[model samples]
Target: EIEAVAASNRVEVKPIVMCRVTQVYETGACVYVYYGVNFFGVDDPLQLFFSIEQACVEVMLRHGAALSHHHGIGKHRKKWLPHVISTPSLRMIQGIKHAIDPTNVFATNNIIDT
Candidate 1:
């Protein structure tokens, strides 16, 4: 999927390292896939990253992969959070935040809204 996206966008996928593993803990089953790509002669770094991430996300969703593997939800990826986290779960998170940081002193645009 990464290769396909790179080809379609005329970008390069130079993965310096690739790793895949699955483990089951008391919490749940987890799948980890990590890779690093080298973008060659990139003119627009922002657009390139967004395009590649979007493509990878779509492919992952199609293949039943979680929206995020290690990275937590942030501003840029908040749009996709709804696809992964349920409404009740989000509300619960917000509630927990409020309980701990009632003033929202540590809140940022990237963190989930209350």
Candidate 2:
């Protein structure tokens, strides 16, 4: 799905799967996906990168995969946090952030929009 998304945007990606960190469960296994893209001739590579990343996330969510495995969410994935978390839970997180950093001086907009 990720490769197809990249291909649709005219970008060829080389995917490297590392099963060493995979977690086995009663139902199935979770494999980590890492890929590299060649942006030698692409204009606005950053935009293209974001487009592919967002598309991949959407595909993963559609297939019942977590938004992230080990790597936590950052500004790039924050927008999708609501999809995985309940609204009240999200509000609680925001409240916690406010309590800890009322002035919003620490990692503003890193996870939730606090």
Candidate 3:
């Protein structure tokens, strides 16, 4: 995936199969994990603010595969929902929800914020 990005794909186009690593495998099975850490430093807090938010949301999304088959659609990734998910996929699956309810009044547990 990183290689594809370096090749100037603009957006991450790889279809990733992610699973949190809780147990080690004894056979030839492969474990695909997005190992991440929330790093905070006292330096340049103003800049760190956005970076921290982005990283935090990403971690949460990665933790909950129920939100997305590959990764949870955290708020930070919402903006790119269009990119990661195909337009047709979005329209076919999500368009109705947003159209009939722009206020997102039906959203119960999902993150819906300004």
- Highest lDDT model number: 2
lDDT of 2 by residue, 15-92 (tens): 443334478888767677666677656676788778878877887778877777667777788888888889999899
Off by over 4 Å in 3: 1-19, 22-41, 52-71, 99-103, 108-114
lDDT string for model 3 (2-91, tens) is: 222222322223323345644445642333445222223234544444554455445545754222444566564566465455678877
Residues forming the 10-long window of minimal summed lDDT in candidate 3: 2-11
- In model 1, the clashing pairs are none
| Residue 27, model 3: Cα distance from true site in angstroms | 17
Which of 1 and 2 is ahead in TM-score?
A: 2
Question: C-alpha displacement of 23 in model 3, angstroms?
Answer: 9.8
Q: Report lDDT (Cα) of residue 67, candidate 1.
A: 64
Could you tell me every candidate's TM-score relative to the true structure? 0.68, 0.76, 0.38
Indicate whether candidate 2 or candidate 3 has the larger lDDT: 2
Candidate 1 lDDT over 7-68, as tens digits, reads 55566655443656577678665666565556776667667678777877777677766765
What RMSD, rounded to one decimal, does every model reach? 3.2, 2.9, 10.6
lDDT of each prediction vs. the true structure? 0.67, 0.73, 0.46
Answer with 1 or 3, whichever has the higher TM-score. 1
Deviation in Å, model 1, residue 112 alpha carbon? 2.9
